[model samples]
Target: MSTEQNNIRFSRRNFLRTSALASGGMLVGFNLFTACKPEAKPAVDIANLNFNDFNAFIKIADNGYVTIFSPNPEIGQGVKTAMPMIIAEELDVEWDKVHVAQAKYNKKEYKRQVAGGSQSIRFGWDALRQTGATTKQMLINAAAAKWGVDANTCKASKGIITNANGDTLGYGEVVSEAAALEVPEDVTLKKPSEYTIIGKDALNVDLDNIVTGKPLFGLDYKADGMVYASVLRPPAFGQKLESFDDAETKKVNGVTDVIKFGDKVAVIGSNTWAAMKGKKALKAVWSDDQNLESTVDHNKELIKILDGKEFDTRREDGNVKKAFAEADKVLERTYDSPFLPHNCMEPMNFYANVTAEKIHLVGPIQTPQWTAGRVAQLLKRKEEEIDLEMTRMGGGFGRRLYGDFALEAAEISNLAKKPVKVVFSREDDMTDGIYRPAIKYRIAASIKDGKLTGYHLKEAAINSNMYDLIPNFFPAGCIPNYKVSTKSYKSDITTGAWRAPYTNFLAFAEQTFFDELAEELKKDPVELRLELLQNVKDSTDEKIEYSGERMENTIKLAAEKSNWKEQKEGVFKGFAAYYSHNTHVAEVAEIEMKDGLPVVKKITAAVDCGILINPTGAINQIQGGVLDGIGHAMYGDLSFENGKPSHKNFDTYRLIRMNETPQVDVHFVKNELSPTGLGEPGLPPAGGAVANAIYKALKNRLYKQPFIKELSSKKSEVLS
Candidate 1:
């Protein structure tokens, strides 16, 4: 059960509305914001269901079938299902009778609707609960009034209300009367012990549509008179389009016209095949605008920055110089990781229809509001004139957060004066992607009299440094003498958020460094981390982002469940714990030697994110994060040559094969502190755990990404 501080609180002025549908149904919705009033407009019809302007999130039909609108974008993170589960639990409705729908973007109806940072549940927990509980209370009042009894004498469960006299009424029969009641200022939310839905396993609502080859994804969307377009963008970062010859492209069988905008050329046709074939036949000339950068150049530049004295100090505590000078021994290691592409299963695509009246955009977008604003600006129209709808995404992984492809679609449609859908072949998606930046970290720890005395860390990257909050994450408050600094070298290659962002690679580097520290001190790795956390638990600092007690509990649970100290014939295990995206996670990786190489066999993970919405969905997310981390650390690499990608397709690029995947076991710490992030925290500790396990199997340590290449070559030193 949640504590008093976490209870759902409401005001008498809360906006609650009820409307009688033209089809004889009732609508009930409660918006937390009291200032904004919904516009008086006609009800909209979707699939023959009437939904009013004020009841955007909930509608109860005459037959007792309920529709709940999910206000956030669905990027395969389970938010589309889990968010509605929260509402259904408090509304006391059967899960089978509920229907989930993806909501169109409406600024007045939703807040923080983007799907990134794994924060949908965390931010929506309170308001969603209030929405359902308030509606349920109104229904109870209506039932009690009908029976001439006190409201406390009525009990509501599973869309039915029963009075003390044993008279029962269905929610549909009393919904119209309930809608007329005043908004309840206080309603009790169910305790965790009484929950029948939130913590239980619930199947995805769209499972049937997904498995039956239905049109649910953005790639499956179509419209009347919509033409297909294939674009030819700059092949290299430092090059731009100087001229193009499209006479041959115009001769292709279904090609209609060719248009050029900025540094890209678009070919239009009746179908995708003709558009692509026309693009293949077109020829374009490019001219260099600056120096073409390569992977080798980036490596040299990062190393130079690390070796130089130019730096920006992010954090400092105590006297690191004094502690280092008085230490008995010092160990330093530099770890490197190459750039990575998102590599979404569905390549970049968006549909746009631009006219003098309105702009219609329909596709998979992580940031719908942001994309709507950008599309309006690019077309020089009002934001209110754009209608944006989000489709189910095959995969986002932060790629859809930037609407570059959506902008291209709108631009092409406006230039050609026809509704167009821009599609990118695998090559176009891979070469013109906002990739994860290449980074390197140099860490040094000083030991004095068998105790860790000081720590120093320096980072070098492309484009931007780590965000300001990361410098204060776990070890910052634990270490007495700690310091951190960073440097960056700008490049034309665009970089943005990818999965766990900075902590994804940072965790691997720091956890392995801690393992080396444990060896130097003759202590167990788990014991060393516990001792470090003890300091944080005793500290009085309030600015720290993670809780030491929660992280310690998570680590202990992972170790106990995985039998960290047990020894089997050829089973080697390694443990790692980290805090990121507002959640604490610990992982234990088990490996076995196969033909003189370490092969990961299984992974056990423990997480503490306060509350679990759906165990089935939560477990799937945890397992996916672990496997993604392991696969990327082992084989995911994107290299560059003269401002162009070295590999553009899966033939040259490698991903983890099915045979390489391992079984994952997950455990969650039961608590009621309110839910945090779940989609990303499980991933940060996975890479570090696997790396430590590999070192146990082999005596050598790895300092670079694509660990398979280093293992195959037997490279004992840094590869970059």
Candidate 2:
């Protein structure tokens, strides 16, 4: 509301625009209100909360319920549940009184909206607290103004402010009057000890809706006179659109339209089943121009190129060559991981209604604002002319970060000249998905007196789908005398961010190699890591280091919880740990080689993401991440031959089933900061931890991924 603040953040003319947006009572359903507001009494707020330039985050209804517009989304990672809890705690509102909604696009009010790289909480930490406090202060100010009392005499708690005499005013009473006032400046935040809702076990805000099967997902979105459509894409990556004769497809019943579009043919009908039926009727021809595409051969080429050349050095330490020369002995090995599909349960789908001037879209997307801009460009309109509604996603393991389906929907809508919903069939979703890039890594370690003296490592990845993350990682100074080089080979296969991006590869290669070095040095891996990590301080120091204290706590906790030192009856335990996204995690995998098969019996993990936002939710994410990593490392591979993917379905690209999910026990060490990202930080370690466990059980190193397969081979035997 300050003139200087306004001039800096917003244009003079938009002051009216901002005022109208806040007060116009535009009931057309911005979809920020759930598009399901009750017609009757809801105990709405008496005054609106001020957020400076930020959007109206705390919208209180007449019925004493508060709605918070969260910029990020809820794609089963439980943001809808966990994010609001932070506010409800800070704002001192009852859980039952809170109603959370996804925010519309507003560049000034929000940052970190795309929600990948586990940066949600890292960026939201300061901003969200400010969000909650700004709104709370405004409410308190409103109550104070209405009572003709000084603001300092009024205190806000549990959606109400009371004077010294204990006379209270509900938030609904003065919200309208407060909405007319200038938004407050200098809102103060609460002390950590005063937090009541945060750090507490706040159940998911959407739990009831999800459990009761309300319309909480994109697949459930429906409108009147909606038609279903199916896209006929190539069965493999290299295959392309050749001339297709639709004469055989026009005869099918229930088929309405045969629309020819770029790279695909659409079969449209009155119902999903009918569209699917018509799609099956089409007999189209595709050129095998890309028949030579193969992820396997790509992997081989990457390894060859990696061995021949050295690319950019991600990190370098003291005289690596000299250190290697002085070492007593040096050992080297090559490791590989295959391409993996996200295979979200819902598959990729989007609905769009396009016109000459405007477009309306709804779908499960990670970046709603970015999608809107791209859709506008694709539709040849201004970004503001487009209205996008974010729907709950079944899953988004970094697969949906690219809005391919949104673009597809825009194309379908523009062509159909009607509101169209483009749904990728399970088959199309499986084969066409951008998968985790397959990577090839070569590592060399020089050890002396069972103490690591030097290390030289390089990773050659299928660069076509990934870029280097070394600029933002811990390789610079986590340890002494370390050299890490990175090179990427572009591949024909579409690759993208899997769960942890390059961290998965980094963890497997570095941790496994560290284990090997520890064995040679005759030192416990945990103790050895402590020796290296203890000297490095914070990421801001000259030798950028992960917080050694946090890492030590996680390792110590995992060691104790797993009863690490005691020999188990039949299970072999191995430990691996890493820090990412401001969180520290250490894991110990208990394994049993049953029938020569690496059966992960259980896992014990310790994490310190700062103050636990939701203990159960954090634990759930760790367990799920561990299971997902196992699936990727074991039976999952997007094999290709003749320039086409070999595995297109779950039957071919197998996932780790419930039977394979180990008995996971997770513990979070209490710490100082708020919460950091919990969703993805756990994934990088499971693959490495499991690999180390396999190595412990089988002494001979299995340098390849899916170690279970190689170790469990018919003729192969365990090292022990």
Candidate 3:
């Protein structure tokens, strides 16, 4: 096919429009080669092979260097390096010769540009491999044509094409010819046995840049002629802007303008510090007559809702009531987890330059396409007129999934009539909302013949409408009769997706309950879980959300690696296993108690995500997730009083520091199944493991999060 003809057939926009393999969806076959025309001119370098603006994913330059564009955001998950490594493996190129670039948000071109739900690698695995394989075939075909040999007889290795006769051609040498050739409709992919890069311990591409403190994060983004902006949002959830006085703020040095947008007031200045000072000087007043709910009121409302008859039945099987009635005993317990703030290290920040012709936005965001769509709607402009770019995120943990910060920046820039970078101070970010919902779980299990015959879970939350509650959580299908129901109370506090979402709280409640059940039955907790999984494995169901074998394997591996059977003088072990984002994870926590406080010492984790793209990156993700889970479970909590968050900053709202972090060891199960997500699976189980260990050490049950304070209160009451 002529380059022009190929371009028409395989243009990014048309390709994405026609293909069913949208981003974050199941993979489908894509044919890059269909129609062809006679070639026009032969340029020696592929750099000059500008075939009608065809933006092929894999680009070969004249210097034999290859560039691959990663489509997802880099949210400290190591996707930036691991994804391109997949392409390099199939393209048969040396790791050092490959360069990775972050692709901007282009839905029509990239189809789905999102970094949420831990679906980046899962959705990109097949498509990215096919991209590299097809490009390699084109290069091989070009080399074969030059040598007058069959294309099938030419093999590509390390950016070179070789024939049976020992004749060879560098990928750079045949780039022009390759670009003129038609893409292969079907190409062979390398088997795991033949991979040289996929399973290896490849270092992160940005490691050097990060180590040297290079400017790569959204907080470090800067543009020429850009001003700084700080916004003062409503003090309370249901409150609205009443009035603001900016005359005094205008007198502040470097202050430019004070812009108001409904519930927010933005202060623009020559620098970030000045903007913050000017924002404080505005002394905005907000209307507080809406009678917004407080945390204590919400908790009471949740309990009242749980007591009410109204419920949404997510999943139910068999006769739970009958089984409970026939049981020898029924154990009931209620667990609560307080709301939490993401508290991302970098805080929320974004840069925007909105003009009459186009809007330019650059920042750290997990969902770029969604943000672009929102910006287009807000600005009353076409999607094409907005340019969105992503930078490396300091930390996401589901906070970046929302693009409100980016929208605020764009709004401020448009009103200011200049480029503006919206910066959120730590205090502003913490109190500005979008928090993890406070949740309540009431569990009841029927015991018959020393086994669980029936199970019922009733979950109540504030604004459950924001997130879908899963009725069929872990151990759902494993039991004979199971029932799960949910209820919610309405509130104005903004709630959003946190790491592992529902699984985070569910695992803690379910696993800790199981530990209690194990003691009641005089059986080992790990053994009891395995027994339940065995029932799932032996079941005749045609569909199961989680792999029984994978879950069982990880549980066994984690126990074995953590020395679950061993007894230590001062260490107590706790075990937990869960499945989320299509990945199975089992963790064992070793904890010690000192001075009436639980001290976590170490955590051993086993994960089954099928295949590992980069072992080093995988381990890093596991460690980070483990620490985050532990930190939040131990000290994370957000409360409201008088219609506003009582904990305004880190001082009142506790966070786990480095000195409190435990050593983490991670292990991946050996498997051949297609890869799954890694960003969140490692987290759901950590809380349960740590909480269970604390219970073992203290002989006291912790039914609420921010367990440090709970334990302290219990100890004080006992002393009194």
Best by lDDT: 1
lDDT of each: 0.84, 0.70, 0.80
Which is the winner by lDDT between candidate 2 and candidate 3? 3
Q: What is the TM-score of each candidate against the true structure?
A: 0.94, 0.89, 0.92
lDDT of 2: 0.70
Tens digits of per-residue lDDT for model 2 on 54-144?
A: 2235566545577777767677776777767766665667777877887756544443356566655544554455446655666678788
Tens digits of lDDT, candidate 1, 182-221? 7777778887777798999998888899999999888899
Provide the lDDT at 368 for model 3. 85
- Backbone clashes under 3 angstroms, per model: 0, 24, 2
Off by over 4 Å in 1: 1-7, 12-18, 28-56, 290-296, 715-720
Cα error, candidate 1, residue 501 (Å) = 0.9
Tell me the deviation in Å of residue 259 in model 1.
1.2
Clashes of 3: 2
Comparing 2 and 3 on TM-score, the stronger one: 3
- In candidate 2, position 372 carries an lDDT of 76
